[model samples]
Target: MAKKVWVERNKDGSWDAFGDDGAHIKFGHGQGLFDPGDLMKLALAGCAALSSQVAVESTLGEGKGATISVDGTYDDELKGFASFKEQIELDASSAGLHNEDVEKFKERVQKHIERSCMVMHTYEHATPVSEEITVKQ
Candidate 1:
């Protein structure tokens, strides 16, 4: 894997971060397209998506046998701290899987991906956070 890198901000309430693909993600006293909490949700959803893909391929097989997609949303009241609603959804199709099997996939996602998502775990456990930002100028 590539090096894990991050850009940060000073404690006055600011942040600086960039995506590996060269996308800028920043925050300052409440700015930017995303925040810590939002990122966590995204991470959980992303993990679920990837894990589901892996699970589907392993369980069902590959080569035009099945197609899988996932969408996720989380409830703010459930997650707490984060007011924005997060919901996760899944869209899948398979030539070999019946409706029952699809349901099984959902179960697997609920049991494995949703349950094991790193961010989801963090949110469920309520982890502590330490933040600091220092200005360059």
Candidate 2:
């Protein structure tokens, strides 16, 4: 499947991004919308969180009381993200998982997320982006 988004520059120097699902986001200072970098961070964190949650639910039979936190730094020199870290916490006792089971579950979940997260995979293996400009007469 393929997804597409449209971004249009407004006259006031702001921009609006329209998704295929009728969702839109405004971008610019004072626009009350997320900037591009913020959106990237959100995507990375959200992917990790969702993947971890699913893994937890499937492995532990429930996902209650599980929390995932992700943080990273954008490197201008490298033109990419750096120092990405994700922390996942779960109350395995409530889910009836023993200590060994908890540790095994955490390891397996982390591995699955690292392998399955699309954003993380893209960040690791960045693809080249190219643009072509067209002028309307």
Among all candidates shown, the one with the greatest TM-score: 2
Per-residue CA lDDT of candidate 1, range 34-114, in tens?
666566556666666665566655665663122323233556677645332345454454436778987887687567666
lDDT of 2 by residue, 13-109 (tens): 8889898888887886556766777777777777877777777777667635356666678799988676677676775665677779877887887
Q: In model 1, which runs have C-alpha deviations exceeding 4 angstroms?
A: 1-4, 8-32, 59-86, 94-96, 131-137
| lDDT of all predictions | 0.59, 0.76
What value of lDDT does candidate 1 attain over all alpha carbons? 0.59
Error of 1 at 73 (Å): 11
**C-alpha positional error of residue 127 in candidate 1 after TM-score superposition, expressed in Å:** 1.1
* TM-score of every candidate relative to the true structure: 0.53, 0.73
